[model samples]
Target: MMKLFHSPTSPYVRKVMACVLLRGLQGKVELVPTSPMQNPGDLQAANPLGKIPCLVTEDGTAIYDSPVICEYLDGLGNAAPLFPAPGPARIASLTLQALADGIADAAVARQQGRAQQEEAGPTPRQAAFQERQLAAIRRGLAALEASPPAALAEIGAVAAACALGYLDLRLPELGWRATHPKLAAWLASVEASPALSRTLPPTA
Candidate 1:
């Protein structure tokens, strides 16, 4: 079985795990919990960047980053491909995935900002940085709401679900649902999937 380095609360890792379950390849892969912040040697050996969701193939080829890992898993089973083949649909899915991933990135930045404020009292600079991330998230959410995905069966939808899930998990104060009802509704439907439900980030 392939091995995956991941953290229970990582949205990126959640995306990959969701993909694995969606593809019916759960039994083919093993999850190894890891934290990049701690820089574990095993993670480093698998991925120099020490990132979670790194998949080590049977041939020992290590694939880092969620996009790559998810694609690798999508190919493992005869189930419908989460990532559409190269074409207009593929372009659309990849674009949506990028936007969703951007939201996740901004959310993480906001979380780090909170930590910085807690460690060393809130500062004008930290506030400014957070405002910027919030703005980015707002823009991303608006984009998704304007043109919702045709269906939540592609990589893009998977990514968007995890991104919104992370926001709900780590930054509820943002109140994204109030501003983007359409996106929220779509996310709610996607979250109903058994595969996605199984990969929900651990609380506390």
Candidate 2:
């Protein structure tokens, strides 16, 4: 069996799990509850960065981060490739994935900045850091609204949905739906899909 360093709150972990579910390999992967902040020995052994969503194959080969893990899973089953073949289409999809992941990155950055702000009592540096992340997130969301992914079929679409879901989980105060209606509508239209519905964060 394969082992996955797992955390329900992690968007990165959710991406891998979404891929696993989409590929119908749920039973093959064993979920190991892990907290990267705690720097667990077993997780570190598999992923030096101690990141959740690290996959240790049955043969002890470890694959890391969300994008790489998603790509790896794309190679597993014949349920149609989430990743496209080499060409302009693949490049476009990867670019969208990068943008979506950047949105997720900004959300995580704001969380870290919030923690630091809470600890240090709201310094100028903390405020600036959070503001930058928020700006980036807004820009990315705006870009998506201008042209959303077709559906939750490809890796880019999956990643975009995951990133949006993560933002909803961590930053409900954003209330992005009112502003970015198209992206919100797009998400609502496919949020019930098997891959997304199954891998949604534990939030209700």
Candidate 3:
């Protein structure tokens, strides 16, 4: 069996968990709740970056970062493929994945910055940094609004759902759903999928 360092509220970890469920690997993988900020020694031992969603394979080969882990899981089961084959479709899926991941990245950074600001008060540099993150999130939302994914059938769609879920979790003040109705509708349509529903980021 494999072991995964995990956190219930991390978008990246949630992404990996969704993929695990989609690929029917849940029983085969152990979820070890981890706090990366606390820098647990075992998590560091498996992944130098000390990130959650780090997968330690049966033989102890560690795989990391959510995208790589999802791709790895895609190879292990008979379930429909999340990743597309080598072709234009694959490229499109990958590009979409990148865009979705970029949104998740910016949103996470912006949330962290907000937490820091609450403790230390906002500085000009931090405020500028946060504005840049916010801009990236808005642009990503617009792009997806123009062309939302087709449910959670592929890696890109799964990623988009996870990203938007994060927004609902940590940045509800963004009011993204009102501004990106199409994307919001798309997400609403798929949020009930077994993979997505089961892996939802924790509210607390």
lDDT computed for candidate 2: 0.90
For model 2, how does the per-residue alpha-carbon lDDT over 1-204 read when each residue is reduced to its tens digit?
Answer: 999999988888888888898888988999999989998999999888877789999999999988999999999977889899999989989999999999999999899889888888998878988999999999999999999998777899888988999999999999999999999899999999898898888885
Give lDDT for model 3: 0.91
Per-residue alpha-carbon lDDT of candidate 1 for residues 115-172, written as tens digits (9 for 90 to 100): 9999999899999999999999989988999987656689999998899899989988
Which ranges of candidate 1 are over 4 A from the true structure? none
Clashes of each: 0, 0, 0
| Global lDDT scores for all candidate models | 0.88, 0.90, 0.91
**Weakest 10 consecutive residues, lDDT, candidate 3?**
195-204
The residue pairs that clash in candidate 2, if any, are none
Residue range with the least summed lDDT across 10 consecutive positions in model 2? 195-204
Local error of candidate 3 at residue 178 (angstroms): 0.9
Better of 1 and 3 by TM-score: 3
lDDT of 3 by residue, 1-204 (tens): 999998898888888899999898879999898989998999999999877779999999999989999999999989999999999999999899999989999998998999999999999999999999999999999999999999687999988999999999989998999999999889989998999999888787
Residue-level lDDT for 101 in candidate 2: 90
After superposition, candidate 2 runs with Cα above 4 Å error: none
TM-score of 1: 0.96
Superposed by TM-score, candidate 3 places the C-alpha of residue 203 at a distance from the truth, in angstroms, of 1.1
